[model samples]
Target chain A: MLGGGFAEAVTPLNLLLCLTGVILGTVVGVLPGLGTAMAIALLVPVTFQLDPTGAFIMFAGVYFGGQFGGATTAILLNTPGQSSSMATAFEGFLMAKNRRAPQALATAVLGSFLASIVAVTLVVFFSPLMVNLAVGFGPPEYFALTVLAFLATSAVVTGDMLRGLSSLGIGLAVAMVGIDEQSGAVRFTLGSTQLLDGISVVVVTVGLLAIGEVLHVASRSRRAPATETVASGRPWLSRRDLSRSWRPWLRGTALGIPFGVIPAGGAEIPTFLSYGTEKSLSRRRGGGDEFDRGAIEGVAGPEAANNATTATSLVPLLGLGLPTSATAAIMLGAFQQYGMRPGPLLFTQESDLVWALLASLFIGSAMLLVLNLPFAPIWAKLLRIPRNYLYAGIVVFATLGVYTTRSAVFDVLLLYVIGALGFLLRRYGFPIAPVLIGVILGPLAETSLRRAMAMSQGDVGVLVDSPFAVALYSVLVLAVVVSLVLRARNRRRAA
Target chain B: MSASVHRTTPAGESPALGDGARSFWTGRSELFVGVLVIALGGFLLIRSAMMDVPSSVSFLGPRFFPVVVGTLLAVLGVALSVRTLLPRSAATADEAGGGDGSAVSSAESDSAEAGARSDWKPLLLTGATLAAHLALLQTAGWVIAGALLFWGVSCALGSGHKLRDLGISFVVSAAVQLAFSAGLGLPLPSGVLVGVF
Candidate 1:
């Protein structure tokens, strides 16, 4: 399976798409305030013309490239392009300031490469089991899973649970706007004919992530401090540095794999966990560990952990049709846009496409390593692009992208409206991930719930009749209990 | 807004009053959000009630989920508002020193920084520019509308190179229109240039 997939992915046309995606991803990732989510949102229109397999292959490249590119900016400028790379920015920036910039870049690139390989290999082997489990799910089980997703993301994605919940609620409200499928009753359209078909996820995603981000950044009065360019040399690691980094890389990979499998947010937690673990492990050594002073392990561990989680995050997306992060949520929307739902049936129905996409991840990771090592400095120069021009360009592209989809001006207007909401969400400290997830999952949850109810002849008890549904609900309850207990303990400690 | 700021403060402890007022406003923005959410919930409930589901549909009907969602929103809205209006000292203590406290404070400071010196001039200008582009898009053509948007955004962002920006905006918009409309075969509104291009 893997061999055939690799052969498909390595085709000349697919490889070129991969290159384009990685290059584009790196540029987006290097820019502060531009992210993988926004980049992918903007790319949806461009990919509409391509076959599903080719498009996904490009997306896989973009995802890997985005992560690697974010690490570059985090190291060079102390500005993380994505939240997952925040941990990397800690020691990475320190290393850059200490004139070990090349070594830090090398560690990040190599660590990410190594972890991607491990995580993708894990996905290839383990996704089948996940698909097998999912194949047995009934409507009740799926509804339970959706509930778990909603609860997990809203509860843990943001620091403030209320804000997260509010975001989720807003997303659900947005999701409810179209005509109800079962009853054929128009729900929230306000009698508008244009809205009879419902708000497109593409419009919502682009509006919230891209346009909203632009508006928020524009509203800021203060300019970011000018970044000092760090000098780069050949990206070669010394023997001792290599020896110190290997163990942490493995440890971080171990920590990150589970996080991707769970419906918990993104790689942020695992990366931080990896960093903390490396810090403690170094302290236990009680030697010249340099934990505070730009420890190589600090950079190595979190970089690997971040990449590992990113790779494995595809598991739930591919096998269970569950999205755990904002990017994954957008990817889910992308999958749906192609008229293919990514779940257990996907393996049997479109096994070639799925395998080829998985294979592209491996190919894209290898391309990223090759592209990033020698071109790290060149990519850093992207930072020098004028802020005004860059943002203005984004505005133009965003408008163009929104307009191209369905060629409707109403969508363009809706884009700005949603963008404004996005601005408020950001300003008010609401996590955007849960909102996107809610919008994507809301309809599915409703459908499953209704289907389950109909199946049981309106017997609510049937929702918990299945063992899988019971287990899922049990886990949801346990998650809430554990979080409450942990919060109480933290409050006690703080007091 | 500044008048509200002035009226909210009392006489004696002007400095303390200012700090308190700032925190009060910053801390209570969520109050407005909560109220807005409640309004949305009320609207949803009213709309769902007004929805005329066919008698042939399932017993559950379309209103069931919306009703549930609206109720949840209303409840959550009340909870959020109550949380905001509670005694600040306790809330601050709980939020400030906890494990996630750093995250909260950092985010607060970030918003504070953006809020403190927020120049609405640029924001409003950008909004106006977009509005103008929307109005002109069909009549003036993609080239003109896109150019205006680009130029207006650059100005709003405080770019000093006016002539250069205008020139570049034109080129950029023209290139985009050409690429998208001509190269990619995606039909952009020709507007005034309908015959020429």
Candidate 2:
């Protein structure tokens, strides 16, 4: 099956699609205020005409390329393309500032490549087992899983728990719009015929990440400080840099793969975890480690972790029909558009498509490495473009992307409204990830809860009946408790 | 542009004055966010109540989840508001430090100062441009409306090169129009220049 999948993915047309997708993804990822989610959302309309396998192969390429490409901007410009790259920006940007732009870029690329390869390998091997486990999950278990997702994302993603919860609440409220699925009752449409189908996630994602980011940038009084671009030397790691990076790379991969398997939104948590781990390890080493000042381990570990988590996030999306991030949610929408459902049955029902997608992941990872490594310097030069024209181009693209989705002017209006909300969220320090997660998962959670309730005939005990539910609930409790404890400890230390 | 406006105030005088001003604003901002959340919750509750569900539906009707979510939101909003009103707690102080156990209040003050300095004109202009583009889309076509939007955003962002910006916007909009409509078959409105392209 693996061999056959590879053969399918390696076709001339499919390979061409993969290259186009990756190149597009790189361009978007390198630009500040544009992200993988926005890129994927924009690509969906274009991919509508393609076959499922070919389209998905391109998406995989885009996904890998976007994740890897973000590092270039983060390193050179001190501006992350997305929040997941925030950790990369922390140390990688410092490295570039210290005149090691080439080294930082190379470290990021190699780390991403290595972790992606490991993650894809894990997916190829462990997906069957995951599918079997997922097949056993009923409504109660699935509801438990979503609860876990909500708790994990809201609790872990943001620094302020209250703000995160508020963001989550706002997202759930947004999700509640349009007609109710069960009773055919129109909930929050406010007598608009166009909104009966609900606010499209494409519009929401593009609005928040793209349009909102542009607004936020525009509102800033001070432009970003001029970046010091040095002549990038040959992209290679020293013997010392290699030896130092390898362990962190492996550790980051280990830390990141599990996050992907679960619906933990994006790679934000794992990348942070990797960075924190590398920082502590370097600190303990205590001899010229330079952990605070552009440590290579700091860049390598988090970059690897981010790409690894991105690759593995597909496991849940593919095998369990759960979308952990905004991009995944959009991909899930794409799946539905084709009248194909993703889950345990997907493997059997659409075996060829699944294989081709899996095969494309490997090919895309390799393609990303080939494209990014040699061109890291050129990609960094994207920052030299005039800010006005760059941002103006983004606005035009964003408008076109949103308008093309449903050709409804109402969506364009909604886009600005959501963009305003996004700006406020950022200004007030509200984490945007939970909102996207909630919008994606809220309906599924409601459906699952209702199904569970109907099954038990309002007994309510059915929610905790299964062992899986019990285990999931226990984990949720543990996660909340641990986060609370950590918060208290940090507070005490601060005091 | 306005390089003279970038001159820094005397460091000591500004920090002391800024801190006094910032704390008050931060506290009020938190309260405002809380009130907004509570209001949204109330709206959701009212809207959910107005939802006409069929009597045939069982215990888990459409209103149950919305009501629950609204109630939770309202409660959380109150908590957030109360927390903001109370004297500064150590936990929140730590949170203001960026949660890394570093510089207690400086990080908070820096970001607050940055926020204070934000210029809203560009944001407003961008919003206006989007609105105008959407309004003109049907009457003016993709090329004209999109180019106008592009030019408007460029001007808003402080681009001085009008002719250059206009040329770029025209080329970009036309290129996108061609790619999406001609290449991909996505129907874009072709208003005034309907037959020309």
- Quality class of the docking in candidate 1, CAPRI style: acceptable
Model 2 residue B147 lDDT score? 96
- Residue A182 displacement (Å), model 1: 1.3
State the lDDT of candidate 1 residue by residue for B4-53, as single tens digits: 21233323122335665865554355577789778878888999999989
Scored against the true structure, residue A13 in model 2 reaches a CA lDDT of 98
List of chain B TM-scores, one per candidate: 0.74, 0.72
State the lDDT at B8 in candidate 1. 38
Model 1 off-target regions past 4 Å? B1-27, B94-117
Q: Which run of 10 residues does model 1 chain A get worst, by summed lDDT?
A: A155-164
- Candidate 1, residue A412: the lDDT equals 87
